[model samples]
Target: MTDAITPHPFAFPDAALEDLRDRLSRTRWPDRETVDDWSQGAPLARMQGLIDYWRDAYDWHAAEARLNALDPSTTRIDGLDIHFLHLRSPEPDAVPLVLTHGWPGSVFEFMQAAPLLADPRAHGGDPRDAFHVVIPSLPGFGLTEKPTETGWTPERTAHAWVELMRRLGYDRFVAQGGDWGYAITNELGGIGAPAVQAVHFNMFPVFETMEAVDAQEERALKRLRDFKENESGYQIEQTQSPQTIGYGLNDSPVGLAAWFYEKYEQWTDHGGDPESLLSRDEMLDNITLYWLTATATSSARIYWQSMANWQEREIEVPVGFTLFPRDIHETSERWVKERYPTLVHYNEAPKGGHFAAWEQPESFTEEVRASFRHTRQPL
Candidate 1:
């Protein structure tokens, strides 16, 4: 058997990428609007600048080559073809950590931190903290199987990932995630998987009810409501009418980039310009993943499957939760403690945005490692 059964490392062919560059160069741009602010979505002017750079300067081959240099390999667990970066530390006792990414994110999230985690001495960290990292492209998200059937919710994804780690010979390992990762990591531990010693997450959902509201929770509730009303239009579109909006995203490369540009622009603590935080090259690499795999529509299916008559799951695993300020309004500590009684460690990060894994990898990794240092492995 050939590796063709599963997506191999840096599977993107050069010819297809060249086609994308050519298409981007020939973008049928819309009429220039005389606007200084982005009251609408992606500003035509800014995106044009990015597009120009993307076409003229940004090299997909170079970016893809750098990604290829990371050494991606494939494995099988429970009849699913799992694509992952299985970077091992030099130390024999290195703790294996399984990382999962969310929608609009890929295994690329760990690209920067791979070397450091596998060899901390080179990065100024103690070797004692060295780790063997396994970053997987979730089924239907990245290079993993984009199942044509339904039932790939957070819970199911977590279950499959747990099996993935166990199959890798990690009888006891740590699990960490952000975004949809937060939801799934909770479930990963909740299922009482004996292999998963501890779970860490950057985006945790503290249960909320119409009945409970203190002064602080009340204010956060107001902010959440305000954010939803003003800034969550994209999510509403994604959650409700993904199929309808899929045409624009799937049809044109520019349209697809613009849609994602809006997210990077708004979600990031970008100081104003999306390009400031994410350069044209960095952003497009992620977009290119969707483009090459044609997984954009399939990725949206997670929202439809989960939120469409979706019910929440109960988490009973020992958890390490880090609540970022900009992350969906802070759940009252009282609420978190009450809801997640099994939570062993909780930290409130003063700085970070939704893309915690990318925005603050050092902080995110340190917190996750420290939180699970005393991982309570079950017999």
Candidate 2:
């Protein structure tokens, strides 16, 4: 294993682009959905529109340039090469922050937010709101090396993150995440990670055990039940047979795009059109990363590795929750407090959804800033 943290510039090769284009062009599309809407999944016409844009308009070179501008790097941690973007703030007393990305998302989700968080002054914010940001692609995702062994659960990833920060010479830091990122950040809080001062989650992972449900809680429970019943087929397959499905996803570009695009549509708050929230290029950028990395199987293995039980776990450090209104379910403050007794901050944004930072970076940034302000250094 190499000890040096080498500077790594992202360059998607020409051959890969050609192969992707060829696959997209020669896509053997399926019959259109029986319904006219996205209830059955992403409609054939919608997917075709995406394919057209991806093939004719999307520019990988421009995306690569944007990525390259970030000063990304890779370092070996636990025998795996972890790729991360480290952006230092101009503020002399800027707090260190490590942001983790989850499934169906990558470090790219935070691309727009990175500069704002790192150098708020440049983006019309006070210097005191600055953070020295570190965005690491999780194991088996994006540029990070896929683990060969079977022990890369959220718990393990939390430990690896601590080491990653320690190696970067940060003895203290805060963590932020949503979706699977939220799970890992919660795990860090659970284990009392030595360097993690406090943690924030947009998608709070608190499950309520209610014997009596009120109107609001009833609605939330209904949404949870709906998710379990209708929207979790992908989870079942990924958790059960990730390698089997990986074959199709790794082999077919359209299949991969549709699979991810469907989630972006359903999971995001875009009035049934994900494109309304995130640009096609942004969506394809993430999907293309998953495709180019051939991480379909490796990334899905995380679900298989950590799908045992959804037992409640205690988080030790101060916790903050940014409640996005259109997220999967709405858990009340009472339910959240049950799990996070140290809950210091809670606010529900009028806009945004599951991918809060990506869809509404400004609101998400403010929530993060307010969430950790009390814990910031020089307090």
Candidate 3:
């Protein structure tokens, strides 16, 4: 039997785009937050600014053309249709790398970086650094189908990625990710799948046990505490009651925009405004993907499914991490080594944040290239 994967082009109809604008134009009003600062949540004025642009100025057709240019396709794995962008490099010896995106992130995050990784020579990098990049939208996230029932955890996703790569005729390859993609990649290596030769992550997981608290570690620890105290309300709501919030997010375009824009503000390296780092178009492109796909509830279910799998596992394969300065939960080298014993490469990027690949595609490509350069020659 053949591994018959289907080619599914990303084509959203004109009516859908019109409907999105209609919803944005008719957004219900919310009173201004009592405090001037963004203490409570997304400020009404800020969301209104975003909505104004989304309703009037944002161009979905241009974004759709870019997405379609990637030549996206789909394959059925474990009874669910998976959406991915597979770009083959000109270099014969190019490494096969599967890149994964997490929540509030779609394949759009890697759109700029994928071609850079695949054809580094064209982008003013060494020909030896080329990679055959495959970027998959997580099961419930983008063009992929949402699970009808439960059990779509990170472990399951890891297995699906392994199979997906194998179906693409890759016997052995490398993996890289951030956010939920981090957990899935770690789990992939931890499962001891011979197909996964080495893995890398921009967002590293920190085990609960602490070793020492140096100045850097102290700052990271404080940030972790701050996240749990102040920034975890969305996490709790999504993990606990995704369906409740999903209703509002599904019904209202502004509600969905506010929900994600808040993270883009807090998580990115930019000033208070997320628009400073990512253009209104870049952000809306992703937000609109979620809107058209109707994945608000489905995407949140991953948190609930993988809540228990948050702890570190013994990943036997070699691993690399490029820690961006502004990312949340900045684990120290020592902390990371404790969990990833076979850590072979680690670098601290001067710029970017949680969405490194999306924010700084060049920096992200350089780090990814460096990480796997040594691991390229067959295992």
Candidate with top lDDT is 3
How much is 133 displaced in model 1, in angstroms?
0.8
Assess each prediction's global lDDT (C-alpha) against the native. Answer: 0.73, 0.86, 0.87
* Separate clash counts for every candidate: 0, 0, 0
TM-score of each: 0.90, 0.96, 0.97
lDDT of 1 by residue, 1-379 (tens): 2223233777577788788788887888998666778776777888898788767787777767766675576666556677777777886667888888886788777777677776787788877777788888887766777777877778877777776666666767788887777767777777764667677777755333533558867766776776677777767777887777777777678888888887777666667676776677788888878778777777777777776554545667677778766665556667677767877888887676677767667877677767876663221
lDDT (Cα, tens digit) per residue for candidate 3, span 1-379:
3477888887889899899988877777988899997898988888888899998898888988888877688889998888888998998888899999998899999989999999988989999989999999998998998999898888889899988988998888999999999889888778765789889999975534565569988778777878888888888988888899899999998989999998898899996667889999999999999999999989988888886556656888888999998887787888778778889999999889899999999999999999998677732
Q: Model 2: how far is 88 from its true place, Å? A: 0.6
RMSD of 3: 1.4
**Two-way TM-score contest, 1 vs 2, winner:** 2
TM-score of 1: 0.90
Span of 10 residues, lowest total lDDT, candidate 2? 204-213
